[model samples]
Target chain A: MPLPPSPPRLSIGAVAGKTVPRLADLPWLIGYAAAFAAAHQAAAGWGGQGFYSLLYPAAGVRLALLWSRGPRLTLAVMATELIVQTIAGIIVPGQAGWLTAANGVARPALTYGIVVWLVRHVAARSQSSLGVAPMPLGLAAVTAPVAATMAALPWTLFSPELTGVSGLRQTVASLTGFVVGDLLGVLLIAPPLLWVVHAWQYRPRALHRPTLRQLAGLAEAAVVLGAAIAASTLLAEIGLGVPAAPALLAVAWIGLRFGRTAGWCAIVIVAAIVLPFTATDLPVAERLALHMSLASIVVVGYLAGSFADAQARAQSDLSRRDRMLFQAERLKTLRAMSVAVIHEISQPLSTLAIEAKHLHEITVAADPDIAQTAALIDRKAAALSTLVRRLRRFGGRSVDEPSALPLSALVETVTALTRAEARAARVVVEVSPIDPDLVVFGQEIELAQAVVNLVRNAVQACDGRVALSAHQNDDRVVVMVANRCPDRREARPGMGVGALVARAIVEAHGGTVERVTHADGTICATLSLPRPGAET
Target chain B: MTLPANQPDRAAVYVVDDDHDLGAAVARLLCRHGHAAEPFLDPVMLLSVYAEAPALCIVTDIMMGDLDGFGFADRVRMIDPAVAIVFMTAWPTTANAVDSVRRYGGLDYLEKPLDETRLLSAVDEGVAWSRRQRSIRARTAALSARERQVFDLLVQGHSNKAVADILGLSPKTVEDHRAAIVAKTGTNGLAQLIALAR
Candidate 1:
């Protein structure tokens, strides 16, 4: 024979809205009731006496069966209870026993049926609230008392011995208990569990460590949290008479601060405080309404907080994208610069290598004095090699790190190094007087690289005359490299390697760089850096 | 030091370039090797020098401000039909090589930064070819007008009958002219006659 087909699975949201329950829903109800019974036993002493002792177990079973499935599972549970009582009576063999068992089974079956009706009604109302149409708080308030009165009907109608007691009093007590229990279940248990499961499904792992700046942002967030809570609390006290406004404020603050986890903790604490007091006098309908209201607030706050967090994360991503683009552009400029440098330097280096080799051979075979001359030539070649290495490092890939560097000394050194190149190309390089003690914070290698690029570009731009000058204005130090290119038209601003790199370096150091073409056709690159100890 | 008497018929090596340093360097190297090398900074100067004496081999830079190496070689070939040309460039490419072959009669192309060893070797090869061409010219110059015409006809692969019809003479007269051409060229067979034509 073929195996029986399994029942269809329904999502939690579907369970909340479905009109009829499936066969599998009955076992789920039993499990829910058993769990509630265990929770009640753990809370109150398990050995407690009297009918009140049974109340916790009975309420647990009722709530578990109520929320686990629809009216169909509830009706099955009621029938199961009746069957159990009838079986006990059959075993006992007495008229009084059978009559008492029948009465007991009948009463509970009636009460269970009422609970099923109440749960379905409330679930319908909650579904409507989730839709585009707004849920009326007035309708919920009225439903709480009505559902409570229905729950109490079986007890009142079956016990005729207590005829003098008003039905209204019993109805009120039953309604209060039902409403309180329902509110407690939703507010204390629902949102946090949903949030945990949602978080697990969506964001399962942390990708990055918090940087120093991000840690500082977290500190700022704490201050903002405190302020938002105070503001929300004041608004809640003025609007709603609930004494727990401050506590609700605290929950909202934590949600906005550390996010969803802390928010749920705050919700639980507030619910535990409010549930007992609100449940005491009111009918079941009013109590349930109160719980639903509180739950709604927590859910809305959590969602809003998550949205704000996502926006902040997106902004951070944009900043990182911009930084990458800037780095890529800088790299492209460096490549072009290296190519130009290679083309310019190759001829000189080749000539020096060949001449040195020839001189070495002649000295080895001829005069002793020529040996000293060859040694000097070798030293010059070594110096050129060192210069080439420096140029390569300047153009090569490296991370940026800040250190104290003597600005004037760096400028002077680059000028001296490029002097020979300038002379060979028949161009003049002049360095103006600068303060000896001026120290700027930057990556020394990068700063030197940028300055070299600018000077080289300026030399290439001018025919022969180029001036490098430095001046201090208040808290800023400005270095200007100007070249006279009278016949040449204005070149595109950021064309060469040095100008592009100079801008990157200066900006990296929290400074500014500007290129100005004068009326006299002299192109000037001005680099302005903050004076030592000056605020950026 | 005794100088050789002016051999007016001796072929001269031509050096044409825009770079003063490179042209002078090549001229000095050529002089050391006992070859007459004239250096010109411009194609116009090279043309002027060629008016005095036809060059044995022309070495020129491909890139110049005016009259690039290819155009100069073409003009030189127009003036003197027998001069051989070689090209030097910083950019060596197959297209340039093909172009040099097509336009300038298949001259050797050298890439710069020019290796001195390769430059000298190419120059020597060009000079040796020029010497062989000079010798051929000397032999050709010794032939009488009628003998030269008969030799040209034989080199064209015209049989005695075809040669007699084209020359408007009898086949016997054509045969007589062919025998004389064989004697003057010092060739024993028709294959040797083709070798002499080359």
Candidate 2:
């Protein structure tokens, strides 16, 4: 039986190709044909044409293909089924004729085509990616009965004479066999096949490599699968009541603990051990009872796996976001502290340079020893100043360190750093006195680099003056940088890389940078960042 | 260290800076170069004692806690117009250099870790310029009020008759006053008188 389409979340692990089969699709089709012939040969002894077997894994192959490759391949699917059956000698035109062969082809084709279409329809309405997530048991339960009825319809209506049923009661009994076989096939076969398709398509790179814990979980589930198989087979052979009980309990545990992939594997393993018993000579009621018990196990296993997959995905997403936020925060704090410290030391450094030079001049003529010492001081101070200047240059740093940085200190440091540049450009820089307590959370060095770039650009962009100021509005701090461009023709259409860099930095901190050019020749750039403790 | 003997004609120079150690060091360097140099930590303190005994030149820091170097120069200019001002700053730029000369009447603007050669040369030139200015002012100060008016007109290339008409005096009296202006100011001719005024 074909598995019901689950939500796209679990199914998205595979690359779903919507186009019809090309040369690339031949391998999967050939593989499916081989599985179909093998399954047919295995169930040949069960009843008439092996159609009454407890599990139809071929139904799963059809569903998996239709789910991933889309419904356009239904014709190709019917053709392949006819070819496989003809080669296996199940369809001999000389004996049952072509009509029976046509009915046989039409049965699974119509049944599984509707099954895939219905699954895609439900997945579409829920806005899910097709075949990405594991098939949920709820969708399976809904599609299984429809698949059973559809699979049985072609045989009941077109080939009743071939079925050897004379009346309504016998016909209904024959129909029940087809329904139970197809239903049991879908429940048992489709989920594991979908998972195999997912794993194969996403192998090596696209699929997330399983971590150690996940591998360990799979190993644990494997052990439980082994125990369940051994116990179920021993119990059934001894004619013990509730032979599937241990297997059902083990499947539920695997589904909830190891997620859908492992859960489906366990279910398939358990089904393989128990399903062949239907071929043995037994009472019809007892065979039906065994099929029902296996069906219940399939449903329980899928439901638990679906729940586990959803929980794991939600947890992984939350932690990843948290890690990014922490890194950004740490980066901003360290940057701010370093910038402020550099600005403070710059004045004393200038004094050191002057004093050292003076000392050298005073001692040079009279005392050779003192003169050499003074020269050393002068040289070291000059080297230190060069290092400081290089450090003060705008260079991008790691964005992981962060802290709450005062807006007042940030603006002051940047203004001081750019003072000589502004003077060289013949522009006067006016910083509006900011409230000392106003602070924003971000990487300090990056924010300073952004502000410095803006100020230097403003100086170069304007005629005479650049004004920088900041103010608090609720939980946000907005820093405004405006420059006077007396000649409107000189105003640039864009602030270029400076504004782009600032925008990227501010936006990273969940803020915005807005720039406006006025007709009066004043260009204003405003940076709005979330104040400390105000970010949601 | 023993004090070097002071030159009798040493130029009186003042160094004003916010950094006390830097200011003192610059002053000592200036003194070693044979100038009666003194250091002032604050521009305000420098200004308070400036009027009593004015220096020939002043070297001041541009970025200061109280009055900036420009403001200080302006005040000093009001007290003694001949005092040469040289501006210095930790941060130097083309705009500051232009403003130092054009707006603040500075002889030069220098950046710190001071070049001793440039500082000494600037101070020497400023002292010579200040001396010339003082000499001219003293010679011009000797003229009587009436002769001073006549001298001003003559310096403008006005004829003796035109000077008399503008001053509302007779041509004989105006010519007599011009001679008195030349005698009192020690100017040999109209060209010398005009050169002195400039």
Q: Which candidate is the best by lDDT?
A: 2
DockQ of all candidate complexes: 0.02, 0.11
User: What overall lDDT, based on C-alpha atoms, would model 2 receive against the true structure?
Assistant: 0.73
lDDT of 2 at B49: 88
B66-88 per-residue lDDT for model 2 (tens digits): 79999999998999999998988
lDDT of 2 by residue, A1-536 (tens): 11122333323323234324668668877887888778666655545332356555566667667666656577677778888887877676677456666666657665676666767556545434222234433364337545756666666666677665556655665555655666656656666676576577556466578899988887888788778777876776788765778888899999888777677778777666666666687666676677667777876786677767766754654575566558768876777877666655655776687677767767889578888999999889878766765565542233235777888889988988999998888889999899999988888878998889788778887878899999998888999999876532212333355666677888898888877765444778888888788755
Best by TM-score: 2
- The lowest-lDDT stretch of 10 consecutive residues in candidate 1 chain A is A46-55
Q: In candidate 2 chain B, what residue range of length 10 has the lowest lDDT sum? A: B1-10
Model 1 lDDT per residue over A1-536, tens place: 11111233557765544534556565655555455445545433211111112113344344334433334455555555555445534324366445544554445435544554554455444423221111222222233333544654565567533322346654444444344343334334534444443465457577688899767856665555455455655765798544334445555565666544445555555555554655365544454455545645554444434444544544554575567669878987978777466434633553454355446656875677888889678567656745654554455323324656777888877887788878987998988778877777777767777777778877877879889887877888788889987442323333444565678788887788777766445778888888778884
lDDT of 2 at A256: 89
TM-score of each: 0.44, 0.52
